[model samples]
Structure formats: structure tokens, C-alpha cells
Target: MGKAKYLSAVEQGMVVGARRTGLSVSRTATLLCFSCSTFYQELPHKLTEQDRQLLKCVLHKNHLSSVTTLTTEYQTASGSNVSTKTVRRELHEMGFHGRAATHKTKITMHCPNSLLEW
Candidate 1:
């Protein structure tokens, strides 16, 4: 019930496997090749200068670019590699769905049908 460290699904599965095998935490940590303290501690990733520049360019100029475009541009401009998925994930975290607009038909709405005949 206490605060859980930031473990991925794979790491969680590893922990579960260790528990199922009746190995001690230290043993599990050893098997994973990471210190027990490191396993339990959360290490947050800070944004790099390139990432800050990306955010800045997007916000300052109202930039609208696809994940592929962003990644291509970023690599060209910053001389670093970036995956399209990472760009997309960052956009989603920033509340951008990376879509022009979501489609919704009138049939999906529950408005009064009589309005259609009027």
C-alpha cells in the first residue's frame, strides 16, 4: 500500500517471477544486476535540451507536425535520434492527440429525432 517505485511491466513481471521462485529480494536484485536500493528507488528522467527546444518550437509557433515529421525535423535540427513513438507519447502527454480532428457523425448523438424532420 505504500508508494510503489516506477517499475515497468517487464520489471514487475521479473519481481513476480522472483517471488514465485521463493528468492529473497537481494537475490532478485542480484539476478537483475541492480542494487536493491536502485530497484526500490524511482529515477525520474529529465527532459534534455533538445526536448525543451521541441516544446518551445511547438508552443511558440503553434507548430503542427506529425510524429514522423517531428522526429525527422528533430534529428536534422539537433543531430540526435528520436523515435516517432516517443514524439507521439510526448504529444499525448501534452494533451495533443496528433490528429486533425476526431470524426463524429450525427447518428452517434442522442438529440431529438423530430428535429431532423423540422
Candidate 2:
């Protein structure tokens, strides 16, 4: 058989189209850079069951959960020590992060009438 052409443009177009119309995987893969076989072979890494449960627990309990807290809790509960770095990696994997700053102006102007009321 002859060498097959890479359909990167078609794949990209399909991905964009999928975003618009939500096409099936086979159709999307047919349009991609690699063949459907390659796409199926290189499926993304998904979280294991144990990790998913642990993440659910961590997220459910804490308001200000951080990597340090999660790692410590995981080690204490499961007797398996995971590094802060590892916890951070896991948090990133699960799409969690510490809160970002609120950009509110701090300065306040007070009127003499307001002061008199106080």
C-alpha cells in the first residue's frame, strides 16, 4: 500500500466542528493529524478509582484545601506518603488551585456628614 497522507488540517477542522456540533470520536479522529487507530491508541491518562475517591473526599471537606493539606491528609488516612509536589501535581491534574487575588480598590473617601452619623 502507498504512504497515507497526514490529515492535520482536516483534523483541526473536525475538532473545531466538533466544538460547534459535538461530533463523535470516530468522525473527529478521521479528520485529525493521525489516523483513527493512532488516536484510539494514544487515549489520555484518566484518574484511577482510588485517586478519584480521595480527591472527592479532600474537595468535599475543606474550603481552603491546598497541596500541603491534601498530602498530609492522604498520608495520615492511607498510610501512603505523597509529597507536597505530588499533591500539587494531583491538584493541577484535577483542575484545582489556590484562590486568585481580588482586584478591589482599598482607598475610601469619607464625608463630614458620614462621620457625624457614626
Candidate 3:
């Protein structure tokens, strides 16, 4: 199978329309790089635009904060006791996740005596 893909509303509508026009489900899904199961499954409640904006602000203010802290901050900002998992998921969807630069040591090349002769 190909990599997972998230389709937009228009793309999903096209899929449904394509299926109605006698296109094979697998073929249509493969063309769009989408999974058939996800196409048919109903998604749960998604964060609204306002909620996402608030979350973004909170995240920016606490860039190094943990998921639990973010969740609490979001709740205080938006007056909703959202779950930590939900906050984490929204953060991931918004392209925010834990990542740190790897530490590296400087490298030095040893000079060859034979090559040093002028």
C-alpha cells in the first residue's frame, strides 16, 4: 500500500462522486493515495477554528511546555476542559511535536606528513 493521506473536503466529495460514476473504490482511493476504510469511517469531533487559534496561541506562549500543561492552559484560555490526548492530537495535526537538535562533536582531520612537504 502507499503512504497514508488526508483528503480535503473537495477530494472526499470527488471520491464519493467517483464511486457513484462506476469507479472502483480501490482504484479511486489508490489514485488519491487515500485509504478506503478512512474514507468510509465517520470522524469524531474536530477542533474548531477558534479552538485551534487559541491552542496555537497557548502553544506559542509555551513552546517548551508539556502536553498536560498545554491542555491546562488551553482549558483556562477557552474555558473547556479538553483532554490531554486531544490537545496532543491537535498539536500534532497543527505540525507541532517534540523534536530536539542532536548534539554533535567537532571533527578534525589529521595532517599527513607526506602531504605537508612543500
Candidate 4:
């Protein structure tokens, strides 16, 4: 069965506590609505503290930075290859939403202060 939700530390602890209390794996899994394999699975986080620091620094210096640019900078700073999608995902997780320029200027706008030509 698919995961009902991502298992946080609290959820893992609950599973462990349940197991210690003589609850069977299937019973615990049923109670939590998690698959039996979920208790045995451990997923590592993609970004490190250093990577987060670098991302914060880069974003602070340039608010308009694109995901591609962020990925490039992260790769350069951390010496690790990362995809733009990963960078975009991390940005979203950190609450940075995509920004698009919406303001448009007139095509033919004359200068307010113009000198008379002979």
C-alpha cells in the first residue's frame, strides 16, 4: 500500500513505542495507516546545512535569482551536481515562490526634459 503521509521523527517514535508495547508490525502499521515497509525505510535529506547557508546567502544577495542560476551556484559552492528541479523544489520548501516580471513600459516614451534642436 502507498504511504498515507511522510513519517516524521514523532511517527517513527510512535512505531517504535508500539513495537515495544508488544504490538505486531501489521497492527502498528494499521494503526498508523503506514505500510509495513515504511518502518524500515530511512530517507536522507537532500540538502545539508552548508547547502542551506549557501542558498540563503545567494538569495539574500539576489532576490531575482532563477532556479537555474541557484542550481549553478549551489553546484559551484558545494562541488556537487544538482538539477534545476531540485533547486526549485528546495526553494519552494524554503518558501521562495517563483517570480515573474509583470510591469510593461510604453514602447515610445519621450524624455520629459529634451533640448531644442537647431
lDDT of 2: 0.65
Query: Clash number for every model?
Result: 0, 2, 0, 0
Provide the overall lDDT of each model, using Cα atoms, as 2-decimal numbers. Answer: 0.67, 0.65, 0.83, 0.78
> How do the candidates rank by TM-score, highest first?
3, 4, 2, 1
For candidate 2, lDDT tens digit of each residue in 1-118?
5555544555656565764688666777655534566454444434456965776587668747766777778777767766777667667667777777899988987788968887
lDDT of 4 by residue, 17-102 (tens): 98899999889999989887776564344788788778878777777777788778778877988788777777787888986889
Clashes of 3: 0
Residue pairs in steric clash, candidate 3?
none
Over 4 Å off, model 4: 1-43, 101-118
Worst 10 residues of 2 by lDDT: 38-47
In model 4, pairs of residues that clash are none
Ranking by lDDT: 3, 4, 1, 2
In the range 3-102, model 1's lDDT, one tens digit per residue, is: 5557777887887788689998789888987567756464332457568567557544546755677667766766767687766666666676745687
Stretches off by above 4 angstroms in model 2 are 1-47, 110-118
Number of the predicted model whose lDDT against the real structure is largest: 3
Q: Give the range of the ten consecutive residues with the poorest summed lDDT in model 4.
A: 109-118
Model 3: which ten-residue window has the lowest total lDDT? 37-46
